[model samples]
Target: QRDRFQTLAEYYRIKHGSIGPLRSWMDRHWTVSRDKIETSELHRLIVALNFPVIYTTNYDRNLEVAFEIHGVEYVKVANARDVSKARRDVPYIVKFHGDFDDDSSLVLTETDYLDRLSFDSPLDVRFRSDALGSTVLFIGYSLSDLNIRLLLHRLWQTWSRSGYEADRPPSFIFMAHRDPVEEAVLARWGITVVTGDDDDPEKGLLGFLSRLAALVEANPSDPPTLESGGELP
Candidate 1:
């Protein structure tokens, strides 16, 4: 039987003792040219959102390539030192999970996930700080991820104890499909659920992002998202 709980990378590490070979394989196979990356609608839609900072758990250079291909300026932040390189003029692409460029930073193994669960890493701290004052819209998350769920609960708990929950800015989750159970759980955390009906997950995400992109093109301003500023607990 296949182990369904742990990620494939974690499984490989447990069985073979190291992910060196796997990482090398991915480096060779996952690499793409800037021209090719520019064609991806996922990249285009994301760039169009024009947020000051974009956070993603992905390790690849997809976002960076997309920004370059689209002629948008962006800085990739993978660690504390990179944070200093970020400027206010361009968007910041934060690699929340880790990046391929840094082997020590990749959150591919089980151990890495456990570490992230603590939610005290430099990147996590940065996220918590930014989220406290910015509107956030989470897409491409299953919400089944324990790390993400715990993070959400922590945010909710913070607002609840702040004696200003009502003043808390709204947060949104965009899902391909709606589940009553998931919605109910997230609702208590003050996260609004949005859905798409395109049948295909990629298409569904594209549709939602397209709308946001359109809205941005019409008005050069912040796209409607969950506002996060409330008095800190």
Candidate 2:
């Protein structure tokens, strides 16, 4: 049973007897890195190039710590309230699977998933709009997470139903692997999969992004603005 392909949330539940208590315990103890996690270089790159990032991660605040360490302005969107206050100029760090500060806020259960299906909440609309509008670059995630995959597929389905046209911005995945079968499936639903090379995908992506940043900055027009009002509907 332990060797089976069980989700992290399910595995935790089986081992600990309850997801809430387990996640709550982990919120207090779960550490993503032991080697003093930092993102000073990445922060400098974004600040120097004036690039806005909307990083969606399931983990804790290691990324936020990195940004704060370098004094780069950022906002964390937990719910509609937080989204409403987020500044337009700052980068957004959306914790789709919840964060450490709030235990009940964690979206780790089957029920939590069902709640998101409605997409009625302002936070849900805000996230879906950004996800559908921007070229989302997924990092540190395997395509195997069914919950997340379903959420993305639903977004695509919603867009199609809403009459979003071809000229709309396409969503992209920045994965390390380039499995043809998986890429085909993602492509079928409008998500472009961009794979980094075998040796160093991160470096490859960084180089490409560096070039992209230069090009975007070189343009005389105003920077591309992510909707800051945060109002859904």
Candidate 3:
């Protein structure tokens, strides 16, 4: 299993023998079934805090469903046209990886990643700009994810060579367990490492997010407009 394809594209190519099959598989698994997600405290907190923008790699529509359930207006941007026409009045949920509704837009293979990287696609540009302008808080990610590490490295490189490094905004990652070595490396990349207790890590993370939500609620800033950016706790 460890030697299996490193990307979904390759996995589907070998297993199902074609992209069509792969797309079908993704549609079957990732499509949102319910009109609304069973809102957890964390989801409710996110809706209550109301960040200006929420970027997700997930193909599922859980975030959008949550917004709908709460009667919060939001724009879901998954392609170039969406980005081009995005408005600032409501929160924007950017689905960078791809959305289940669009098979052509999915980025599931190494080829897809390379294509996006080569062209510096609109989504890529949007994420880079947003990352540079605001404080990014990474959640539900693991240190073992090479893609995220590479992205962080690129961001750090950009900041380091920008000459305004002293004024660069800090990024953060929430981890379930404390790994001193990983923490040190992330610190070198200008990322602050926030960790929860290993014992009952999920509960700890929930508490942490709840506290963050409370902070945002108590100090609600104006929603970030199209011309401006906002920070996530």
Per-residue C-alpha lDDT of model 2 across residues 122-168, encoded as one tens digit per residue: 66678777766666655556677665688668877877787864755
**Candidate 2 at 214: error in angstroms?**
6.0
Where is the poorest 10-residue window by lDDT in model 2?
Answer: 224-233
Two-way TM-score contest, 1 vs 2, winner: 1
The residue ranges of model 2 lying beyond 4 angstroms of the native Cα positions read 1-21, 32-35, 39-55, 199-233
Each model's lDDT: 0.79, 0.63, 0.75
Cα misplacement distance, residue 55 of candidate 2 (Å): 4.1
Q: Against the true structure, what is every candidate's RMSD?
A: 4.7, 6.9, 5.0
Of 1 and 3, the candidate ahead on lDDT is 1
Off by over 4 Å in 3: 1-8, 11-18, 31-36, 117-119, 221-233
lDDT of 1 by residue, 37-126 (tens): 877888888887787898998878888888888899988899988887678788999999888888777877767888788889889999
**Of the pair 2 and 3, which is ahead by lDDT?**
3
Clashing pairs in 1: none
